[model samples]
Target: MPDNVPMEQAAILADAVSTPFGAVVHTEVRVGESVGVRGAGGVGTHVVQIARLVGATPVIVMDVNDEVLQRSLDLGADHAFRSDDPALQAKVAEKPYLNRT
Candidate 1:
């Protein structure tokens, strides 16, 4: 936070940082596609929830457990797949390529 910002908001910003293994529940932490934070678990669940909140379309959640796969879909994921699934790639790429200027 800038020096001109309110102390309360600065305190809120200060609360955002945490170590992964040391994170406490009910506290928000940043975890955007980092090295060890790929697959869905505790922190990963928070990732999914935030992604859903922000309207990430065609959210493909990959996991081996049937129950967890189902849970991903129920949690607003557009699709879920096992790692070795034959159709996973195709299913994820249903739409044609888009040109970026």
Candidate 2:
């Protein structure tokens, strides 16, 4: 209900902003933590942005589409991978963030 956002756009905007933020809040994500999001679609993209904004480092995004993976990186994910990759687990484990004792 902001002065700038038209009423017609309000619902969509609210959904776009709230869903990801709510998920982040519910999960209690902390600064410098590694975040791995499984999807890079509409709401998943926003999750990447929100995770980065909250200071999560090495934000990893996984999706089946190469384009989506790239988009996640562009949106501030530290790493992107195809969810269907046979080596997905190994690849994710290789990140330095997850190696910490």
Residue lDDT tens for model 1, 1-101: 57899997666433333222233223433333212123555544444555655444545577667777777678766666775678866755563432225
- Model 2 RMSD vs true structure: 1.9
Candidate 2 segments exceeding 4 Å error: 2-8
Considering every candidate listed, which one attains the maximal TM-score? Answer: 2
Model 1 has an lDDT value of 0.52
* Residue-level error in angstroms, candidate 1, position 16: 12
Q: Quote the RMSD, in angstroms, for model 1.
A: 10.6
User: Model 2, range 3-63, lDDT digits (tens) per residue?
Assistant: 9988878876677778999988889999998788999888899999999999998799999
For model 2, what is the C-alpha lDDT against the true structure? 0.90
In candidate 2, position 10 carries an lDDT of 84
Give the whole-model CA lDDT for all candidates, comma-separated: 0.52, 0.90
Worst 10 residues of 1 by lDDT: 29-38
Any residue pairs clashing in model 1, and if so which?
none
Where does candidate 2 clash, by residue pair?
none
